[model samples]
Target: MQGDVGFAQQILSLNLVPRKRLSSCGNDTSLCDFSEMWYGVILWTAVSSLIFHLPAALLALFTLRRHKVARFMPIAILLMGIIGPLTGGVLTSAAIAGVYKAAGKTMISLEALVFGVGQSFCIFVISFLRILATL
Candidate 1:
């Protein structure tokens, strides 16, 4: 049972690591290259989440008057702000890890987790501010 749980965690970890892409210098031959690539992964996910959340927030604001769940908008948005980054993290990480794995390389999960949390925090701050401004 413990082994099964560990295996599941390992699978999740694999998906949480970032994908492989050309570093800022267009090469993946050094640790610096990998770091730069990871930064890009983080930035891409962060920006994507921001783009999605902003429009969603605006739409919710406009529809609040007619929606039955008007009162729940704040709570819902708050929840999604938390969940969105996590979902994005898993997806981006899995995609990147898949690429790296296909090329016979490994990414450190700890770095993934740290960057994911940082990304989530950044998204949360920007989203909160944008929503507050809209309201």
Candidate 2:
């Protein structure tokens, strides 16, 4: 009877341990899932921006001779196209980093911010130039 009781207690303890462990693991997984979701959103936004910007930038570059105002317009547009995106990208990356850090999340790193800025800047410049070209 004594041995049986001891075995039962051991079994109960083992069961309890696994439950706690499982819960902790589940919480970690939840965090990871949220991080992945946020990252996905960022990626989608960046990709969409790129898709929209490409043709616009090309058009702007190609249409410089179409208008009487475009001779000087291309240079101004080119500068804005480059500078606007650069500034916007920097601002965006800084904002993302600040927000994620404030949220106490570990997934948002400096490297991610750098990557995001590069992607955003490229998209912005392309789109801006494209729109300007049409003008």
Candidate 3:
């Protein structure tokens, strides 16, 4: 019985001992594979962007037709429709791509980069027009 207790204690101690100097290398098996996660995040982002922007686009169109707030109302509506969706899509894509890079993945896909750039450009143009409208 004493020998059995000692063996149990030894096993418990071994299990409880903290591991030191965890490896920083990519070989760690515990880390989640982010590839699928990235794809899901990007897809959801695109879908949500479309859903959110659809209603906003409709509202902008209605406002442009009814209120006649400014001569550049068409431009504003276009910006809201195109730029808003593009911005949201790109931001989400970039975030996923960034995670891919952080995970020591060697290949960064071009699709995400293109999406991000297109979205950023749309945002820039939208902001410019908004400023112009204000002026």
Which scores greater on TM-score, model 1 or model 2?
1
TM-score (all chains, Cα) for each model = 0.39, 0.36, 0.34
Clashing pairs in 3: none
Task: Give the best candidate by TM-score.
Answer: 1
What is the per-residue lDDT of model 3 for residues 5-65, given as tens digits with 9 covering 90 to 100? 6653453233221224463434322222344334533544454445545665666666666
Model 2 CA lDDT for position 48: 42
Choose 2 or 3, whichever is better by TM-score: 2
| 20: Cα error in model 1, Å | 18
Cα error, candidate 3, residue 30 (Å) = 15
**Worst 10 contiguous positions by lDDT, candidate 1:** 24-33
- lDDT, each prediction: 0.55, 0.48, 0.49
Give residue 22's lDDT in candidate 3 (0 to 100): 64
lDDT at position 10, candidate 2: 50
Pick the winner on lDDT between candidates 2 and 3. Answer: 3
What is the TM-score ranking, best to worst? 1, 2, 3
Instruction: Tell me the tens digit of each residue's lDDT in model 2 across 28-128.
Output: 32222233424533543454445545565567768766667765654564555456445665455446645655776644223343455466666767766
